[model samples]
Every structure is written in C-alpha cells, then in structure tokens.
Target: MPKPFKIPQSVLVVIYTPAWDVLLIRRTEADPSAPAFWQSVTGSKDTLDEPWEQTAAREVLEETGLDCTPGSALAPHLHDWGLENIYNIYPRWRHRYARGVTHNLERVFGVQVPDGSVVTLNPREHTDYQWLPYDAAADACFSPSNAEAILQLPHYAKQRLGTAA
Candidate 1:
C-alpha cells in the first residue's frame, strides 16, 4: 500500500497596515466538519530550490492575489518578528502531513501596506477578509501560536525600524 502524503512545512505572512492593523479573513465555517478559524496570508514553501524569501513572496501572492516583488521595499514602516512557532496540524488536515509528523514550524513575517489597499482573494483559499486592529485580529485567530506572532508585531517594528514608542 502507498504511504499517505505529508503536508509541506510553511511560512505565515502577517500582512498589516502602516498603523500595525492586521489583515485577517474569516475562513468559511459553513462546513460543520471543519473548525471555525480566522487567519492571515499563509502557504507552504516550495521546493528547496527557491530561497525562503522567495517562498514568502510567493505565498503572499498566491493566497492574497497581491504580487509583491522581491525588490519592493516594505514601506519603512514594516518589520520582521524573529518569532517561530510550531503547531500540530488540525485533525482534519492531518492527511497533509507525514504520518507521525504532526506539527509544523511556521516563521512569521510582517508586511506593511497602505491603509486601504484593495485585496484580491483567491476564492479557493479563503471565503472573506477584513482589516482589523492588531489586538482584535489576534483575538479572532483560532491558533494561539498565530496570535502570539501578531502580538509581537509592534516590538519587531520598533526594534527593526529603530523607532521610539
């Protein structure tokens, strides 16, 4: 018999507004079989051939339909939180991960955008979206590990941008 397919480990991009508001989406909960969850732009790293940054940019575009080039600087307001989290794949998603490989390490990144940049969602990956105050966004997340990343956003902004709070 063939072995089950393992979900690829991935990166989670926390796209935000200049003021630090986070972009979140309410995943379709109509399916009673799946957990109700809200989250930001996230996807798996491609074959190791690509650089990690490329993986990040690729995910941002694939999930949000926003093409962010490697050359575009994240308006001096953005930051990168050197935070990493490991969480178990949801029971319903376990088939994506290798047998016995239950958890994934997700690296967090912050991308600052203009307050009202129109977002184009790839309907297949998400149902609805919203721009929420960081705290509110964090609270709405189904994953505590993800929430922790959001909460640490400001600190990273300050440290990386060298700005006074």
Candidate 2:
C-alpha cells in the first residue's frame, strides 16, 4: 500500500507519578539480536484530521490499554509545558513520514497517576514498561530530545502539585 504524505507533527505524553517518576516503554530494536530500548508513549498525529489532544489520548489507550479522554483527570496532576522538541526520527520510523523528512516536532504533556498503577501495554509496540525517577527515565531514553523533555518534568510537576517552585 502506498504511504500517505508523512505528517511530521506528533505528541509525546510522559505518564508519571507524584514523586517525579515517569513511565518508560522498551521498544524492540531493528536488529533481531539487539536488546530493546526505552522510550515514552509517543506517536504522530493521526492524518491531521484528529485533534492533537485526541491523538494523545488515543495513543495512551492504544499503547497502555487505558481509556483516557482528551482532558480527563486521571489524577489532580496535569500539565502542558508548551515545550517542543525536534529531532531526527528514528530510521525504523522514518518511513512513516514523507520522503526526506528527517526531524519531527513533538509536543510535550504530562499525566500523573498513582505511584504503582498497573498498565496494559500493546506487545507489538513495546516489550516492557517501567516507572522511573525523572532523572533515571531521562537517562534511559535512546533519544536525547526525549531525555531533555523528561528532565523538565519536575518543574511542571511542581506547578501542577502547587508546590513552591
């Protein structure tokens, strides 16, 4: 089947806990022998027809098996940092975009849930998942852009928690 014009736009939702720990999913590497790598729940906008918030919620449900409305209150903590990061799309996923498109614009969001909430993950996209301290989560990511966004979580958490910044 012919691919649709690559939509370089996307959203990156960092599901986390009150303690600044974020969820990480291990993606299967291209090399069959290579070990999987970690990442957040990220995906491109669905055909530019769906709203970005819809895309975020749909991805969350599809990747983690949680039914989340576009702006549902999973917890009291919710944040839109208005942070955008651009980076080269991984070679394996580059095919999803238009030809010659290298970088993708990722909008950042944070959704906090109870510390040990169980998650149901889609096996095809991720092999395993973990909730790690923000710093550790950042280090675990394969993409520098994702790491930088993870590092910014504390500030957003504070704002959402109403803690003294």
Candidate 3:
C-alpha cells in the first residue's frame, strides 16, 4: 500500500533565545543534487484536523528533541505569532503531496528556549544546527518565507516580552 499524501498545511516554528539568537537547522535532503539549507523547525500535521499548536510542538520535538508540550518547561515560552505564509511548494517536493497540490499554507510560531539549551538534531531529518543572531540567520535561510519569518523575530520577541514599542 502507498503512503497517504501529505497535507499541504504546516507549521514553521522559530526557536530562539531571549537575547535574539535564532536556531537554524540544516535539513538532510534525500537527493544529493538538492542543496541542503538552514531553516527553523517545520513539519506538516499528522492528521488533517490537527491543531496548529499541536503540530508545532510535535515538529519541535521531532526536529530538535525539545519538549514544547503544554506541561513542559518550554511550554510557557511557546507562542503563536498569528502570521501565515502561502507559497508554492518546490516542484521537487510536490510529489509528497497529492496530485496537483502545488501550494502550501504555513502557520508561524516562535518558541523561546534558554540561551544555552542543547539541541539534538534528528539524524534522519537534520544533520546539524546552529544559533545565530536573527539577521544572520535570516540571511542563511534559502526559503524566502523562512527568511522573512526570521527577520520578524525581533518584533515577535519584543512583543512576547512586553517590550514592543
């Protein structure tokens, strides 16, 4: 039996520190011809009806081995940025979705982890991770949407800490 087609709806969680250092993970692509690039935690929902927050938490844990669930220590730091991005799925990856599914709707989120928090990348999905200032991280992202999201981190961080002017 073939696997079910993936849902085009997903979450992009920007894990960061209070000081504005953003975490960027290098994805491990199946095709060597496809260059690997840095991005925040991202994944599609397991079921069509899964809540966006739930998907965010799951992706965080799966990609970085961090617990962002409701009762976990990181839970209080998890935040929904109330932003969304719609973009065309790369032609090389559109095969994971159903036929004719060329676009994806991504919900944005942010999670603040301690400055020194250790990140363990999932070998299958990511090969490495790094912490960089928001501006630099944004420049490192290959996806325009992802880069834009990183560029918005300072504003989101300020808002989260009640420091937004």
Q: Which candidate has the highest lDDT of all?
A: 3
Better of 1 and 2 by TM-score: 2
Residue 33 CA error for candidate 2 (Å)? 4.0
Q: Which lDDT value does model 3 have at 42?
A: 95
How many clashing pairs in candidate 1? 5
What is the TM-score of each predicted model, taking all chains together?
Answer: 0.84, 0.86, 0.95
After superposition, the stretches of candidate 1 with alpha carbons farther than 4 Å from their true spots are 1-7, 28-36, 73-79
lDDT of 2 by residue, 1-165 (tens): 886866898888888877888899887553567554788988888777777777777787788875566455662344566888878777877777777999888888777877777799898888889888999999988777788889988788787767856
Number of backbone collisions per candidate, in order?
A: 5, 1, 0
C-alpha lDDT of residue 148 in model 1: 84
lDDT for model 3, please: 0.92
Q: What is the C-alpha lDDT of each candidate?
A: 0.73, 0.79, 0.92
Off by over 4 Å in 3: 30-36
What range of 10 consecutive residues in model 3 has the weakest lDDT sum? 27-36
Model 3: clashing residue pairs?
A: none
Tens-place lDDT digits, model 1, residues 79-126: 346567788787887776667877887777777777887788878777
